[model samples]
Target: MLTDSHTHLYLKNFENDIDIVIQEAKKEGINRFILPNIDETTINKLIDLHKRYKNITYPLIGLHPCSVNKNYPKQIEKLFQKVKNTQFIGIGEIGIDLHWDKTLIEEQKSAFRTQIQWAKKLEIPIVIHCRKAFNEIYTILKEENVKDVGGIFHCFSGTIKEAEKIIDLGFLLGIGGVITFKNSNLSNIIKDIPIEKIVLETDAPYLAPHPMRGHRNEPKYLSIIAKQIASIKSIDIHKIAEITSKNIDNLFFKKNQNII
Candidate 1:
């Protein structure tokens, strides 16, 4: 069994045939999927998907960094109103994305800090999305004095130094299709980081691995990622599966069980 630590099945990319996509993933041994919310607009879709696939899907609620804008406070209020009564696996896909628009940088930071407080209050983990703003994100995390509830750094493509910093902050590095890219420096960093600090993800409908590069990603493609990690680490695929599976089990599932 493989766990996709992060994915957005609520997106329009899977609108037409989500059932079939999920069935195919199960058939491929990609059983568990952790879905992260993008914004208030996607919450209903996220809840719908979780309700439909309760056995295989886990829902995480949060306002994504890129979605942070001038009306972000209003968006966050909507999110909190929706989530206040429920228990979610995490608060996530939240961080700064300077790669797209820098105008909302401070707004994104404010949103991130607020969400971190929510996560701490709820005693849940967080899934962060950082793009070209690692330094700022790290600074906010530090200022918040974040500890205890570590989270996943989704689609991690940072340098070894950055990886170390995140790990030191009690976060796990999420590895996906990028690690399978021949030119991706992620492969080199993965070689040095402990497998215990890694979690597998597809970031589905995006970041498809080599061989399937350019094709729309799906959770079923996770095996290819596991195989690639095994090759890079010079370990057997089963061992890769075992280690990553255990890491995810601890991070998301928490309860002890034989996932295989």
Candidate 2:
């Protein structure tokens, strides 16, 4: 009953054998996959996978920060239109990323604020993607005051202070394969964070855990990440699975248990 709360199974990286990838993931106890949208171009592929996988896959709609540009306003408008017309589980894979390029920083912030407002109005959670701009992202979230429909900070790799700030904002930390990297201190950071305030993700086709580093990641390898966490926390892997799955249920399904 493990859940990969954030993944991009729709990307071309998995296009060749996505069905096999999904099958193998299920066999490894990773039963649910939550696909986050990148931008307008990824909407159809995200929806197609959700339609084909139905109960096992969930979809979110939003523009990634890396996708923001001068035309972000128009892009956000069109993407919001799609969200209104469709039944997405959330709004995200959105936020600010200053890692690669900061040329469109203003545009990225504006787009992030716009999407957060829309999600707040719709009462849907958001999945955030942050890079070298944690302070920038946190400032905007605070300005938006997004505590009501708090979502996840996808691929969180920040300090304990930063983690506390996110939790204070009522958002859950999205822990992923980063926890397994020997060079990453995420395992140490997360050991002090409660399991209830965390969710697992692969951010697949990227950030594959140790032993599989530099390789194309698949959702099937989530068990390896989970096992790593278990070892670090000195808890059974089954408890990690149970608690994290329940955490996902609380956020997405409202603890319904019947929805996904």
Pick the lDDT winner. Answer: 2
lDDT of 1 by residue, 1-260 (tens): 88888889989999999999998988988888999899988999999888888877888989999889898888888897867655588898899999978998889999999999988887778999999999999999999877777899999999999999999999899999999898888898999998899999999989999999999999999999999888888988888888888887777667324322
Of candidate 1, the 10-residue stretch with the lowest lDDT total is 251-260
lDDT of 2 by residue, 107-224 (tens): 9999999999988888889999999999999999999999988899999999999999999999999988889888888888999998889898999999898899999988988888
TM-score of each: 0.95, 0.97
Off by over 4 Å in 1: 255-260
Residue 238 C-alpha lDDT in model 1: 80
Model 2 lDDT at residue 125: 92
Report the CA-based lDDT of candidate 1 relative to the real structure.
0.88
Q: Give the distance in Å from residue 4's predicted Cα in candidate 1 to where it truly belongs.
A: 0.5
